[model samples]
Target: MSINNDDITPSKDNEIREPMYGMSINENPKERNPNSSNKLLGVFYGIGMNVNTIIGSGIVTTPGIIWNLVKSPIVVLLLWFVGGIVSMAGSLSYVELGVIHKISGGETKYLQTAYPQPRIMMSYLFSFMHIFAIRPGIISAVLQSAAQYFWYTLKEHQYDDGIDINTNGWKLPFTPFWYVKLLAIAFLLIITAYHMFNTRWAIYINQTLAVIKLITYSIIAIAGIYRLFADWPTSRTNWQNSLNGNSDITAYSASILLITFSYDGWNSLNYSLDEFRKPEKKLIFSNSISVGIVILVYLLINIAFISVVPAEAILDNDKSSYETIAVVFFYKLFGQSPVTVRIFTALVVLSVIGTAATGIWSLFGVHLLSYSLEVIRYRNKGNLKKEKNDKELNEKSDRSSKIEYEVSLFFVGIFILAGLFILIFSFMVHVECPNYNPNCSLREKRIEQMSPMLISYGFLIIALLFYLFYYCLDTLKRQREAKIIRIADK
Candidate 1:
């Protein structure tokens, strides 16, 4: 078994580019830290990344959808609270597996490590689904919402219809069909370009946007609370009706899907565990803190939404949920001034853009994992030749810059194509929906367009359950193995 000397040596860049026991998404040239022992990030960074990734279009748009289905503010709140719990549970599970495997891939690493028979194929399938269906679907949905708001702001100003100044801000009397969609595609492309080329700038932009989003949310929450108590007519009947609407298992299930979507990224920080200073302790702490913070943020935001906007209004907001229920709530607070609406709409755009950026950034972690697994055959081979073969492959790979660039481009191309395909499909679906329902509202059409994405999440949830089950079995097996080793030694 000849070891690759180049593998052990630093490159011309004076940095080692080896994947740890796992590869992380943070392997870009500028971002790579050579010293493995150096821990750079703290709990706050983790929380910021997690929140940015989790609280996107779902929070802004899904509340109305949930209210439309669940019809109970209390149940919706409970479901969101429960979603946080589920997220925390998932985070804890990831921490356990991450500590042991210490891999860069998120769920892909979990599946690869936990499943018996070493379902490498399943991991590949997961990567395929993630790049094709899951990431693009959700991202397109988010971009669509942001674009809709952006367009809404423009159209309101352009049309200048006789909108009541006392009720709602100036709104477009009708949707701008191709223009809004082209704007959405442009939004997606800008985000993709930012991440694909200027990742450092993208990170800075992401962090700044996250801070702005939190502050905006705080302002919204405080204003809503003030209105609820100080100004808005206090109606116990309104509160009761919100909490006592008709409950159905199906409704709860659908609401749970969206709620969990809002809470989905809590475990994202675990993918970069190697970056943490004291990963064993810090990973768990950061994840727990982040999830707790998300729960608080989510609950407060929902509370604010319900307080300022009545439940009936939210349920009937089928037309403009694609924009934001909060826009209407803010309209009620700040009056019908176009400036207020534009500022609020612009904030929503920035917030969702941050989310899309974080999500795309986090996705590369799984891609890195998949790439690492693809290159390191010995990890799963369980044979004596594993190291020698991997070493040979590493040497060949190290010598060839062109091959690596080609591979990188190949993956990047795949992602871009998938994104474009989904974006086009979203617009096509929007254009064609009227054939089925002549009077389909924008929010309803948006949801209809998002159906494929919801289905993708459904598949992801099933995969998550599979991981949990296998993780338990893997844990027990390890425990049993330790027990046997101890007995034999004794």
Candidate 2:
């Protein structure tokens, strides 16, 4: 569904009249006009979304990877704590920006307001990179991870009755490579279709999943605490030797990057401020509460993992068998029971799914809608300007303008659909070989192909160049308009 420009953009009545941080929206409070069809999201959903998006697969997967990298549990926990601080700082900055702009579109709106000299170039660049590259990459990666966990869980359950179901290869007899790809695609379609049809229900489902995520983490943390107390000797030894490992500077930097990624969705609420019931009061509260919960839960969960699974074990654990630190933790705590491991793996899959759902819902509903509206507005304005000089053209301009707007929308819709299709299917098609063999030419070829990181950055570079090109054209246009005014005056 499209967002109405008038609803999202700040009206003169809603203009900033006080300090941004201390701004009040109650001075001229309009009665809440409730729309059943398009309900505004509340602060509760805001917190839910932040929590759901922020606590995705990263927390479950990265602890072991970080421990492997830094070889220091102390450094891993410190990096995580630092990451939380950075995310909180970012949330505050976004709160201020959201308050000042009082609009949706997040960075797109902020960039336009902050860099108006270049006319809408910054906003366009942000929209281009975000819509085409960043958002899609994130969604695809999350869904792919979710699919892997789901398949892993199924394979584990299959082996419950003494049947060895080999899950080492990319393609197994029971679970083919296409099965995983199709599962991921099915996840994307189901979530996308649900959000498309039922906005209110989608938010409700997100909130429910957010609660489930919190509960899942709490269970892990509590279990860890119990283990720590039950077996203080092991826990104490692990904690004491937390820093007793090789701390390579390069690995430390890389671990920090991973922690930062874990903290990514802290600013998700900024994307849909206009959908909020009362953004001014709720923005800071929602962000603060969400980040705080994630920080506490993350630290506790790490402690829980450390309590049961030592840093050496984390570093030496077979990643092929144990996909995440959580799996290792559960196995250490509950022995080698497939049922217990499958349960936690299922939780991890749910966490990943929640993150994907929130990402797609926000991107499709707010970001794309905002960008499309911006395009339509720009086209209509240019058309109005051109029609002013020719009487005959002015008469037909409305019809032509209508046609142009519809065509622009049609192309935009097609572009978004095509991008989504490519993003989902292409990532699924190129399955990374689980165990790299020198004879695996297809895996080597896949690695040689352009990486998603390079492609995303390439788009950003192109965006900057586009901004510069458009900035020059906009400056020239303004200069000509100024010259015409001066000549008319003479």
Candidate 3:
């Protein structure tokens, strides 16, 4: 009465699953490994990763810039809310792609699978922009904000002089270029090493930092709310003043750009759908809840900031800079001592660095995949050589494998090179326009500030459009093939 294992019927435990990226599933149950640890992610992990990725320097530094543009605090809040809505829409689109493809590699895989017959030039182009410009640009931007806060704090404590936004156009002190660069490089290296050597500790650090960030922001919000309610007469005047300015289309566009960039990391979990246990349910909940939290916290932070520090102080045209708005707000709250201000800045910087550290590994891996097509071609050529020589492919395969390892190393070098270039680019932008200068190196400043906007919004728009176009094309092709099969069977 004993049954052979191979003869056992396919049941819930042994059912064959389809390939993640649309390649044929190996239907032979024997081919499946039972001990692999590639289980789906739980809800909390997915949400934590999403929130961590979404909350970066944007929330800290961009508020003043957003205020300067919109002028009206209510309009600014509305724009942030709209940005959250757009982010949710983008997330749902990505989730749909995940439900269908269920693979990693984000947009690259989506484009490749959707347009398999065409040259797939769009996919490569997307990867190229992401690797060379978008990813590096965003990282450099955040780190630029980090370096600003770092140098500002250092100068405050050591020199007893606040950061001068108009000293020879450099955000650094007298000998500040290399010093700031060194700090930024150190920040990058330290975070990188933390994740590399102490992965579990890094996770703990990220969660701890996230909690600290939440607590700090909540304190700021609560303090402002208490003040608003406690001093209604003064708060009323400030609110009325906050709404008296005019906003043009240019202002709206600028505000939208900054807000969207701040929300850029909202769709981070979409890149790693394979980790999700139930993306269908979890994806919607995670994206929606995380974005909602961000929007609420962002509004509260803005309100708190304006409550303590006047709107003009935030958008100060001369002397005080917008970059130091948070410092000023804290200063007004905590008096002239640099200790409280420095601590506040440090907390903000740590939150940003934690976000970058959480995602750097994935960013590096995506950058390495720039060589994917090259690696595939090299392998095919090696196979051809083995066939022509009638030699066993074991040696050829070994050589090909060695070549791949070398190629990977080469791309790692490229990643480092790109980072250096970006770091330099970031520093140059800071030097050119340290304090949101009206008349700086206009071109470099725009490239530095606007690149992220173009890439973030541009990528989302192009991706969604491509998804629709290719989804329709794919459906038609599949229907035609099915009709042919039905006719043949008849």
Q: Evaluated with lDDT, which candidate comes out highest? A: 2
Off by over 4 Å in 1: 1-39, 116-119, 157-175, 235-237, 243-247, 321-323, 378-490
Backbone clashes, each candidate? 0, 0, 2
Tens digit per residue, CA lDDT, model 3, 1-490: 1012111111111223223322232233223434323445767777777777887778777777777766776777787877776666566556555555444567766666566444465676677667656776777777767776777776763221444544434456545555666677788888778877976687788788777667766777787778777877877665676644566665666666667778878767756665566565567677768877877878887787767776656655454345556676677777677788888778777777766765674564455434554444333331222332223323333432321111133434543553354344332322134446566675665565555456666766776576568668856976887689799999
lDDT of 2 by residue, 279-384 (tens): 6577878888989889998998888887788565564433333235676677787776889888887887887888888888667534654455454444333233
What's the CA error at residue 315 for candidate 2, in Å? 2.5
RMSD of 3: 13.9
Better of 1 and 3 by lDDT: 1
lDDT for 200 (candidate 1)? 73
Runs in model 3 deviating more than 4 A are 1-39, 157-174, 243-247, 336-338, 364-490
- In candidate 2, which residue ranges exceed 4 Å CA deviation? 1-33, 36-38, 157-182, 242-245, 310-313, 321-323, 365-369, 372-450, 461-490
Counting only residues 3 or more apart in sequence or on different chains, how many pairs clash (N, Cα, C under 3 Å) in candidate 3?
A: 2
**How far off is residue 267 in model 2, in Å?**
1.1
Assess each prediction's global lDDT (C-alpha) against the native: 0.63, 0.66, 0.61
Worst 10 residues of 2 by lDDT: 11-20
Judged by lDDT relative to the true structure, which candidate is superior, 2 or 3? Answer: 2
Looking at model 1, report the run of 10 residues with the lowest lDDT sum. 1-10
Mind giving the per-residue lDDT tens digits that candidate 1 earns over 221-321? 78767766785565334456754435566456557666766776776775665465545556777777888887888888777777777555654422554
